[model samples]
Target: MALSVVGVVLCALVSVVSSHGYLSSPASRNSAWRFGFGTQTNYNDNELYCGGREVMHSQNQGRCGVCGDNWRLSEPRPHERGGVYGKGVITAQYRSGQVIPITIRISANHGGWFEFRLCNNNNPRARDSQQCLNKQLLTFADGSRGTRYNLSRSLRGDVTVHVQLPPRLSCTNCVLQWTWVVGNTWGICSDGRGKVGCGPQETFVNCADIQISPKRGFQKPTTTFNKNKNNFLYPRVSLVASVWFAGLVATIERDLEEDVLQTVVFLQRESIPDQDLFIRGGISESLRPPGCSSIVESDPCAIDMNTNLLGTIQHYEKYNAWRVGDTRLDWSGAQPGQDVYQGIPAEGTPLVWTTNNVLSPGYQELNT
Candidate 1:
């Protein structure tokens, strides 16, 4: 009719920009991440009383939103209490190393025997926070994923504590919870719940915000048109395996067993004020203790300098590879510079990334 209604409004604007670039790719931005509530669940878990799927049964399943009953889904050892929980209380706060999981819902008939100690909110209550710490990060109840000690009662409703925090301790006040019931007991709780002292209302479900950047290597710029020559030197590595940022893709097995010899410099884009520029050649060196068999300096440099910025974000998606130079040296392998002005001797000393513009405060020494 009128150019067919302008061709159906340009095909609905190209199907809403191609469904927002396929749900913002990167594996759909890890399921569209959007959950931020340290307290969401007053009660509701009798298996939905009959039907099911309303709230409180998680291995990443359902509920935590809103629903109520005797409230089911709190099993690490909560029937009353048992074993496996050395001590507790942690309050970490860094931001962006990614490890946020947290889920603790407790209300077991409200009795006595209590000892719920899940850490990393600052961890240091006196040399190992009083010992007993078993690792795996605790989170039990048959559903497995460690860190939720045994508050034995035979186990049932109320008590879902799952913790995995890295993103610099992540903050909206950066989550923290530790409840060791009845004498020898500990404190420090804040992941939802303002005032409910008869004890039975401890909710904190942060879920996702993990973008760890402990990155390491993937060097590829002797300068010449910079195309990633031979690629696989420090090829790729970035982890958090579960909620996003996988990008492994490495290769260079000089007989294999962790043999690449350092070379981690990358940055095809993503320049948060010059986020590091680019430089890599086996970061500094030191340490080698797990059985020890040579390859000593201990073991510092390997993969993960943002794994070629996620392979240049899978072919130039956005960029995020920063780590070019300035004493942050934590690598330990490669050392052979004949050119590039001959100054290639940094298996350790070099850390300078922060220079896109605004050069004041003497560039604040690149914020270290």
Candidate 2:
């Protein structure tokens, strides 16, 4: 009995040590951050098989959260009030392809000023690129009405913002919605009707799978996100310039907080990123590398581990390879100019189809 008790105590001590030293270490702190990545797969059987065994192995298949097919997801945008009954919701409307304007309205009360914002995707750490319209005040004291602000070109698409107000003023009759005009009407609109404006319904299509009611909320004092944009309380991204790179591979399944773990290198800009960059779900469509012809037909936005991990890898030596025991390699590299399967050249050799026999399941690695 004493021995068993001792063993249990030792195990607990080891667990604590391991968790602090490795699991919670700066390098591995949030390695698996993703909103619903591990939920399930949505792809058909055939496509799942072709993508490789890793994707096919998931019992849920590609149906997991909003990772595939849809480039956006739905999350409650919270507003705050102190002694005031009304709550504000920051609504974002996507216009053109690159621009999005967000608007906030007070509901349930009126009068006084409210501060609101649109945070970074599920990853608050990703909100480093965030931009604010300003603190909005609606004075029902004078019987005026609510307030609205339009985000500039810099603050649009795949982003979030927050708004706040004081007490006693019940800001009411406010609704958050989107507007789509027949011919190019973009930007935050005062007409809070869904008749073309944006809302949870306009988020990523995959978000439809998960339904949320009364999508807005009151920003609590202990909120997981922050109100000030300059505090550096968000996620940090670093650049390893010169080498081509692609998707993120997580060692374990993570929650919404983990969504900021991935990194991206826009093929168009060969520069090392300086500012903290924010990215939503990766580009859904495939792209070819810049200056490359169509015959190549590769995904431009892919995550390439071959060139990065090639030299140091022990069991795996070749590029775009995968192995059974390997824990990493979870990203999708964009192959811009060449056929995705056209293996990386060896000594200037022409691109050739990689043989499956060598890196086959038990002994092989792949370029997923």
Candidate 3:
């Protein structure tokens, strides 16, 4: 009599635990239940796949709540590894274009077909973090659609399944969902009167969070440059010179008087043996000078320069015309009449050019 009583109690306990099923191999969020942790099972609604119960049913009386649309029991939670359920758990990692092994623990197999779905955590439709609900069916790496794995009769104990991830399916973090619907039940009422029936009408859902690594041996395009290229050799100097020359030309021709004419002349020479000099000049309203116009021109009708001059001689490796050097020229005012022009020289600086307004026309130049 004692042995018979013990056997009955064991069978009763197994019946209570086997009422629902969950993913066991990939370590689901509900794994804590197997070790005497987590909330108690509510047999009335067995859709506790992601640590919560489905409060609503689909239009065809199928399972809901996995998509986070209508979870009646509790709010959605993060589906990461290592919480109250397991120890030092890491998110399951898999590679694209590989076959993944799946194991499910069925307390009492309700005789159903296993269906798998994948959700990209990065997708905008995902509600809870790392939870795979409300996503469309996943496609395998071989370009074939992933459908149901049908079972003819009730299956008890642990069941194993294999799924192939599509070679092109790439995601950093993802959720893999497994749903078991009892055979021939279609997750709907067995009787036409919309009443729940036994056997094929039952459903079990669970999920596992996973990370997908990209395929190995993939190469990315690279950019290359040659040292002998002109642009690569003196990129900064070339850029500066082009910009400066454009600004100088624009300044010489801007805002000319209706009747006044403008002209520009550029002279380059290597005749003075081993020396290169470039001279650029143009005529416009004397109100404008190439480099100092902004400071000196305050009046709209200011006097114009008959001859505007700009000269450059490259000597130093870091030479730039805009910088102050051993020799500097200062000019004030933009009116047609003679304006102040002063030459300040430092030691060892050679005289390049000078001008005396009294000895020339409206503009004067003395070059050495």
lDDT of 3 by residue, 147-172 (tens): 76765445667787778876645443
Model 1 lDDT per residue over 1-368, tens place: 99999999998666322211011111111112212222222122212111122223332243332111113434221111110111211122222333333333333332223222322221111222213222213333335555435444444443433344432221111112233222111233465544323322223221111122221222322222212432223334422222211122222222122321232333232324545324333321223223322232333322222121234433333222122222222333322321122343334322222211122111221221
For model 2, the superposed segments whose C-alpha errors exceed 4 Å read 1-110, 119-368
Give all TM-scores, in the order shown: 0.24, 0.16, 0.42
Off by over 4 Å in 1: 1-103, 106-135, 138-265, 269-278, 281-297, 300-368
Report the lDDT of model 2 for residue 221: 16
lDDT of model number 1:
0.26
lDDT of 2 by residue, 170-288 (tens): 11111221111111112344566543233211111001111011112221112232313212122244342223222121111121133222222111222535432222222211222
Better of 2 and 3 by TM-score: 3
Best candidate, TM-score: 3
Model 3 scores worst on lDDT over the 10 consecutive residues at 348-357
Report model 2's TM-score to 2 decimal places: 0.16
For all candidates, the clash counts are: 69, 67, 11
In lDDT terms, how accurate is model 3? 0.42
